[model samples]
Target: MKQWNIGVYFSLRFQEIAGALDSALAVPILVPVQSSHSDENSQDLTLKQSVTLLESLRSCWSEDVLLISCADKFLRLSLQLLSRYSNWLSSGLADWKKGSVSSNPGCEWAISALPDDFIIHDINWLAKRICGDYLEGILQLLSTCSTEVLDLVKKSILHGGKSLSDLLPSVINTIIEALVDKSVEDLRQLKGITATYRMTNKPLPVRHSPYVAGILRPLKIAGCSRWRTSNNIFDRRC
Candidate 1:
């Protein structure tokens, strides 16, 4: 059994999992749900399914019959999966750049103070849920394994042994800042809000600001509390 895990079968399974991640995460995830909501998410679930497909092999260790390390397999496999997600995000950010970022100079700072723009809700959710929450969870899972397994898996990925502080935070920040840049770029109607007060000499209306509300509909659909953007990923709080 250990031989199977350490040899041809393991290699085949690893390729299959990498293929699964490509199939699942490659397309542009255009938008999140519009109305109803559920905690059961297919994106993260796809990641979990890929992990469990191999993690289940841990059964071999219990009988003292396993010489292979499941931890090594898990780390490599998880990195393979995240590589797919990171690629997809790279594409999105690139596409956004061609159409959005070059036009805006303050992209680096805009993400720090972006409005609750709806166009980027899906991007926001993925970065927050998958990269933020899910990656943290994956790290915790690795902590359960022996250091030998962790050390071995490091060779499987670039910067696999470096402190996350030295790597991931900047990458995540760039993607988010790009998304925020796109969101802020879409605020064409913003001038109209002030125009209503400037053009009209009539008394101030008591009703809620329609133009502002229209701009915030994405927040309404996604929920005000659910939306969050990071000014500084280097601060390690996304």
Candidate 2:
């Protein structure tokens, strides 16, 4: 009888698992769901399988396994899978407070089970992956992320192994976009609440006096003017 090599067995099994994930994640980007019924169905099936496999892998994770030489492959695969399924995971997160069931329960479970170090690694990988071609989509994704994720992304960009000079333009664009989005959101919320008060014939909360608003208006305008001038300069540089 031949003796079994336990080490070889585990190595082969790990490779098989990683290969399965690689195949699942190889699905090509299809046309918009509205444009191609068959492609949409195929994409959905691929994502479902990927999410299922991800949860299975998460269940098997341990400190010992994570220390293995092949673990980086698993980590890269996990990050790619997470990025693809981020929308599903984020939607699930919003339902946590309401005790509502998630649409993608497996994704929610897998994401919640990920270690903090893994999360940080994933964020760093994503930061390094961003490029001019994918800047808009990546920024949109990051903008909707939690503060913890955002902070990690910033740290990765500023302190990670990349050259700062090469990333300056992308960094500038990201900051401008984030600032603009935040300002717009704040203004929208303020206008919405004030409008609601007007509709209900209720007096608005008196946090700031009318004199304060008068003083702030010119300052706000000046800030906007400065931003516009800077934006013009950015456009010229680009």
Candidate 3:
């Protein structure tokens, strides 16, 4: 089996779409923050650099989905690092305040505050900055993935269990339904071609049944389109 770097694939796909768009906005490349477990000092430095990059890109905010993608790849590393940094700032401010009284207290206080001159490092603010529209650009990106990559995603979801489903938008169910319908249509076409080839003793064109089957099997296994339907029956008797 081949290993796929889903994070890189997702970022590249997002960039490709952003480039084709008419707007001047570009998707910002969010580098995942490193964990503090390995080299705390270096991790802190990298975290600061990531923060600086985000600040620079704030003016051209395209979608918070990009940040969500980063969080998905990095898991709790990004959140934990940011939270620790914020606490560090608060503790440092307290120490500074106890040690010396600045001649200009207002300026000093404003400079020391977390949200005053920087992104609020809390989870809620981070969510606002990273998931503002709530999976707006995500579906677009997911639709563009190649069938092979989609298969890999399906496997990952299965191995990781259903909890991963919460990370996906409800709109994905509709997309899956469309995919299954298309696959069924393709299979029908392939069957017709196979029948024609058998009768005429001519070689059939390359069959895409396998590819379509590969795509649909995982979707069915994952229950991507499991929804209930109801038919209304009304009768009036006077």
Which model scores highest in TM-score? Answer: 1
Q: Which stretches in model 3 have alpha-carbon errors above 4 Å? A: 1-73, 100-128, 131-238
Report the C-alpha lDDT of model 1 over 1-238, residue by residue, as the tens digit. 5345466655766666556555444332333232222323322222232233223322222233223355455455656554444444444444444454333222322223232233233333443444444544444556666777555543433332232223244455554564454456547667676787898996887886555555545445435433332211212221
What lDDT would each prediction earn against the true structure?
0.42, 0.41, 0.36
Worst 10-residue stretch by lDDT in candidate 3? 229-238
Per-residue lDDT of candidate 2, residues 48-139 (tens digit): 33334444344224444443343334445444444444433343334433345455433343333211122222233334443232233323
Name the Cα RMSD for model 1: 10.4
- Which residue window of length 10 is worst by lDDT in model 2? 28-37
Q: Is candidate 1 or candidate 2 better by TM-score?
A: 1
lDDT value, residue 197 of candidate 3: 69
RMSD of 2: 19.4
Show where candidate 1 strays beyond 4 Å: 1-7, 28-78, 100-209, 224-238
User: What is the TM-score (0 to 1) of candidate 1?
Assistant: 0.41
